[model samples]
Target: MSTMSAKIVHISIDRDWREVYGYASRPQNMPFWASGLAFGLMQDGDDWIAEGTLGAARVRFTPHNDFGVIDHRVTLGSGLQVHNSLRIVPNGDGCEVMFTLLRLPGMTEEQFAADAAHVLRDLKTLKELMER
Candidate 1:
């Protein structure tokens, strides 16, 4: 299988890993940090309907687990689906939250870089919120 290019943007939070995962994994709290879902997400059965990022999209999040995995898939209105891998891992006395951003099909280097920047900003926002 072909592998897509990726960037893992992450931030360290001075909080427990489980606590960070619990707060961050909730859909209701996404808008506060995840700019793409800043407009908010509406529950639609098993998936959530979001109106941010690139127009309207449907997002499917992973089921809650003891492991700090919050992977999700976003399907755009155009049917382009993107998979995001997010994790909260113990780091020192706190935890590290990481987001893997994959370079989607037809994505230019400039676009990929911009996406990475956006993810970094989001992670920073998460760190700030969690540390507060």
Candidate 2:
């Protein structure tokens, strides 16, 4: 269990959940919208290994499906396992993407804030890419 609380950040997109899930669920597409993972990744079967803002990480994402669950686990270079729970749900005429930022032990308040901001930006990027 984490020592700190988790933060929920969300953004509404003008698209369907299927469309959002189709694009965001793929780890290969991460570099395009996720700034923290913009360095790209190497896929080895079900695992995606990449070096990014948080250092080298091995990521395992949820499989493709109609449900907009884009949850994934990231093992950092420091041996920290972070579980990111992301979801896309229908909202009126569009959809809303929600990202849960889990605060691990030893993480500063500022760092958590920065991570939340980064996720918000990434969601915005996804929206832009999908709406185009």
Candidate 3:
């Protein structure tokens, strides 16, 4: 397995960083910030399971706080297992978001890095959306 991490600093939105993060953390609110992403809720034992499209990838969200741990299984192409944890923190007049993704067995380091960049870009896009 391989590990990849990204940090996005200074997302200067007017709202409180915690609140903004909380908004993003919700499964129902994903499409608002993520633009094209779609999600559906299902019951999985005692926990709520969120199945959704994150860009071209199929992602599953397990509940957390203003942060989340995502289990992503790629569809329509190569099979990749991605486990990710996300956090948003206050930084100066803005906020900083940190993402850590661990690539499960069978995925290469290069693929993990490439996917990490994509994830960061998505965060940047979401930040822009929140700021505007």
TM-scores, each model vs. reference? 0.96, 0.92, 0.58
lDDT per residue as tens, model 2, 68-126: 88888999987888888999898877899999888778879998998789888888999
- Which regions of candidate 2 fall more than 4 Å away from where they truly are? none
| Local distance difference test, candidate 1 | 0.93
Tell me which of candidates 1 and 3 scores higher on lDDT. 1
Q: Candidate 1 vs. truth: CA RMSD?
A: 1.0
The TM-score of predicted model 2 comes to 0.92
Best by TM-score: 1
User: By descending TM-score, how would the candidates be arranged?
Assistant: 1, 2, 3
43-102 in candidate 1: lDDT tens per residue?
Answer: 999999999968999999999999899999999999988899999999988999999999
14-81, model 3: which lDDT tens digit per residue? 55677667777765666555433545444455334444543344455555653423333333224454
Report lDDT (CA) for all predictions: 0.93, 0.87, 0.56
Q: Which stretches of candidate 3 lie above 4 Å from their native place?
A: 1-15, 34-46, 50-83
How do all the candidates rank in terms of lDDT, highest first?
A: 1, 2, 3
